[model samples]
Target: MDLLRSLPLGLYLEQPVTWLHRLDPRVKMAWLMSILVTPILASPEWRFFLVLLLLVLTLSARVPLRVWRQQMGWLLLLSGLVLLLTMVMPDGLVVAQQPRLPSPAEISQLTEPFETLPPLPQPTGYQYVIYDRWPITITQRSLELGIRISTLLFTLIYGTNLFLLTTAPEEITAALEDVMAPLRWFKLPVTEIALTVTLALRFIPLVLEEVQNLVRSVQTRAINWKKLGFRGSAQVWLQVVERLLENLLMRAEQIAAAMAVRGFTSPDEHKVEWHRFVLRAWDWFALGLLAVFWWARLVWGGEA
Candidate 1:
């Protein structure tokens, strides 16, 4: 019933800060974008390599087993299921057609018998149908599609999860603001946008807390579901939802009032630096490695 602990999707891990936590958020953001974007139109081998790379990063970082097990285990299982299902499904290669010319029987009857030309020497040993049996058939196209889909699914989810796991909400907003600094030239309110993001990230835990409290309160009331029919249960949940919204609005109001009391009129007037953005030696090293990553991707990751 503890939603916060059970579903730690965007929450940060504060204890036992790993090397991943120490790396500059900007570098991490760049790496995250690379992981997400590099798989497009890439070969299946490259896609699978991306998945393996994520696993290696997680292991090398020494993320707590409890944390990653919960995050990655189900994700891996789901991706594997997708791979299997995709492989078994039809790959749209099968087609039936009528021959334009005569069949072999008719040709033989029409022409004089001649020694069958020796079968043309086989060239490459490539087979379109990878596996065929009674109930299952796998084609090269199907296998490729399966690998593409499953690896993309795993990479998309786990890459973002890893970033959020190590980086704090403030750090995330700061990184985003830094990255978006160039947009300010077009009269964009970059500071305001960053402040909004900061507040939104901070509000996530509050939303979760409100939900947990409401659910706990409902459970403690010991409402008799047997006595109250389905309609009654629905009405009770509706009331809970209404109260949750009211509480959230009140929380927002309180935050605004607190800001007003602190004389925070505008983001430009009062800026709070969350984390000083600096590229340490390790961060520079990471950026260099990222460049190398893209180089290899361009050189060999393209689809045949």
Candidate 2:
């Protein structure tokens, strides 16, 4: 878990071979926009784009098959974990609805939410549920749901790979708020959001550094190495933990000193200039097309 937690976002980001990374942020955003949109309509639907996504990542990055294979190990583990989680969660076992006694709220509610509706149907395996003698065939629904989830996972894997491979996490966070600036209407604080995101990325390295430091300290103190075997291992672990706490204290003190030196306050921005970011023409076209496609899909052929 620790190893996976320490995995760099860059590990997923692939180096682009084509014009993708070169495109204006917006154009690059739009060109592959349907990569996200098309799958949405794909309930029991498959997109050429899904496979295309993989091909694009593989081709553009020219990553070794082994790297993909390594991902596969995690994927398999994830698939199993998903299956298990979905199978065991609240309604996961039934995969459909079952009724329970309504609360006083439901009984006294002015809302007559349910009428003569039959007992909430539960999803039987891969559809084809047994409703008395009748069956609710949901093979398509089941397949689509699974595919939808798989595609989501695929996007995450590919997108993370795409981001880490090309730009630093700092850059991606910058892009996110910059592109999503329209949301400020609802009073979204994009800058703070970006700061939080950057800190989250920074936290990864900070944690790993702390672990390494602790491990090294333990290694240097070889006195306990020969004195205890299994017990010694336990003592080393305890020592590592103590050292980890000490490191955290030191870091906390450094942060305090740095903040003091800068006269930092909660209200001030980090004084970072985002203009240094490259927003090329291709990027603009890509983003524009993405918006247009997304609008068309939602307006003309919505999730009907």
Candidate 3:
């Protein structure tokens, strides 16, 4: 139910902005996109590269190490999932503790009296890729591929964690609106786009908190979460989900009523002053640093 439980995640995301937050939201989002994809493109063993990137951002925002430490559970969960997939993949040549072949001693039990059996030996590493003349499927690569993908997934999740931790939801919403403004020429309802983002930002934390509360309540009633089997856990989850729906409905109604009372008209009802959001001298310096970072990666340094 940890998945169901709203982590105290959003609270961290409301991180106090320093130099990083002052950069235009559009610029930050661009930076994040590059940072996310860069890791995926980076070699599998280049996790250290991502780690360094994370550390630099953390220091830049003056983010707490303790908060990052708290997220270790989620990081482990992701890594464990990767390890499990690697161990149980079906398509790869299967390896086993007990050899399927008959040992020399067991050859005497052969149906034919003169039949002889070759000795069975445990393999250290003899992974032969069995040729499948049928159409090659990418899913066969799912586990190993999944492991690779998980690396990027965790990287982005943590990067996003940093962003959320260091920036306020309102600031993020403003950022989203600023980023989406370019689509206005296409008659895109930029306001609606911004609203979707704000609502998601608001609801993620709300739902996480609600779930944690319910899980704690369930625990108090003597249901042991750890010992529950898959089906048993699923049933408990269903009930929790039902309750969540009810809670969400009530909250939605309250929001609707509240908005009606106040003139909370639209997601982009109020525009942010671009000048106010612009890069200050420090922000300009940070932008220059970011450019240098990209230049080094793209040019002679050749290490992103």
lDDT of each: 0.93, 0.58, 0.66
Candidate 2 lDDT, tens digit per residue, 1-304? 3554446334534433434444444334434455655666643324434545556655665655554556655764675566444333333244766668676677778566555556776675444331223233324345445545655666656554554555556556767777888998988777778777876776666767788766665668666555678886787688678878888778767866886689765523544755465766656665776677566555654445
Q: What would the per-residue lDDT of candidate 1 be over residues 13-98, giving only the tens digit for each residue?
A: 89779999999999999999999999998988899899999999989999889888977879999999999999999999669988
**Between the candidate structures 1 and 2, which one is better when assessed by TM-score?**
1
Candidate 2: RMSD to truth: 11.0
Question: Model 3: per-residue lDDT, tens digit, 1-304?
Answer: 4653335454544345466656666566767776776664454445456656776777767755566666756775876687556534555575667877767676677766555569889667543433334453334355445556666666777777766666667677777777778899999998787767777777776676777788787878998766988889899889988998899888878878987687777655654443347656766675676788677555543333
lDDT of 2 at 288: 71
Ranking by lDDT: 1, 3, 2
| TM, every model | 0.91, 0.56, 0.63
Candidate 2 TM-score, C-alpha based: 0.56
Q: Model 3 off-target regions past 4 Å? A: 1-24, 43-47, 59-61, 72-154, 216-240, 264-275, 300-304
Output the number of the lDDT-best candidate. Answer: 1
Full candidate order by TM-score, most accurate first: 1, 3, 2
Task: Tell me how candidate 3 scores on lDDT.
Answer: 0.66
**Candidate 1 global CA lDDT score:** 0.93
